[model samples]
Target: MARPNSSPKASISPQKKNSSSPREADFDIQQELSRLQEVIYESFHIPVSRWTIIDEDKVLEQLEFIGTKIPEAIRKALQVLEQKQEILANAEAYAQRIIQQAQEEAAEILDESGIIQQAQHEANQIRQQVQSECEAIQAQTMAEIEQQRQMANGEVEQIYRKSVSEAQQIQEGADEYADAVLTRLEQELGEMLGVVRNGRQQLYNHSAQRQTNNSGKQLSEG
Candidate 1:
């Protein structure tokens, strides 16, 4: 059988037509997700704390743009990520500045024991970690640095107390040694005095005996 001259026209999908958007894919989960992230970034963060500070109105307005025409929204999301990177870079610079300041202060505390030097070394290590994981670092940065500072201070206190105790023990031991030596010297001097007294008594007794013998002989001669 012969088909009709007018064939059924191919129906085009409206969804397919829009899929070729220059910026946003028609149903891109990634684009939607990025838009959501941008919205959040535009909504909440602290400036002084070295993080984002987003506006609520802007957050809501941008969120409304999701699932619809999202080309502009995705662009903004990319911008937000870049801004985050910039903020992170600024934070790293600030951290380095603080480290330099701390190093200068730590120099005064470091001595022959090098206890504070160890603390500074650990601080530098922390700074390195921050640099390595900058994208992931957050509020915990302050806490970590503070904890290290407290630990350093505690170590210094412990070293000081230990040093004082050892010094006192040394002084006490020296005093005891001196006392023992003096006691021995006194005993030896007493023994020498006794020997001198015995020798004097023997000499006196001999002289008296000799005088008596001489007197007796003279009497016999008379």
Candidate 2:
């Protein structure tokens, strides 16, 4: 037997649904772009994207990490600045000390230079005085030496003249004494010769008288 004819719509739901306009998908693109970077970061560790919607507790933890690191970086920068200030202060003090030392040394050099100049001037004055005195004494000494030489020359000439006169007188006296002795010897020799001649004449006269008497006696005998 054939079944009674059935409608195609019998298995479908019996309630009628109203259809006017389909609802459109509402999306915030700016918000999605802002969370894109966070989504990439979370995907590295958690394997979840912010586009998939994250939990409130995870976002709070990321904000706390950034806050703590900022204060620590600021503290380190302040410490470096303080150290540089101390180094600059020390350099300034050293420069001042060097300048003071140079000024004091310059003053001392000027004082010593003045003292040396004064001493040189005094030495020049004393040297001039001594030179004048020496010249005067030299002149006096030359005059005394000349006077003594003249007196000695005069005494020597007088002594030479007296010695020559005494020698001449002695020579004359010797010649006169020799002449007187020769005269006395010649007179004594003449007197002795005259006495011998008279004796011989007397003997001759006696012999002649004796011969004459003999001749007379012979004539008488004849």
RMSD to truth, every model: 30.0, 69.2
User: Which lDDT value does model 1 have at 27?
Assistant: 39
Task: Tell me how candidate 1 scores on lDDT.
Answer: 0.47
Per-residue C-alpha lDDT of model 1 across residues 1-222, encoded as one tens digit per residue: 111222222232112223447443443434544554544443444444545555556556645655354444334333332343344556566656655665565455343233455656655775676466554543443443344335444453333324334435534543453344335434533443344455556666888999999999999999
* Model 1 weakest lDDT span, ten residues long: 1-10
How many residue pairs clash per model?
A: 2, 0
Tell me each candidate's TM-score: 0.29, 0.28
Residue 131's lDDT within candidate 1 is 61
Candidate 2, residues 1-222, lDDT tens digits: the string is 112222332332232222443211222222222343353333323233223334445555544543444344333333332343333334334433433443343344334333334333433443343344334534543453354335434443333323334334433432342233223323422332233234334444665666777777888877
- In model 2, what is the error at residue 102, expressed in angstroms? 1.9
Error of 1 at 120 (Å): 62
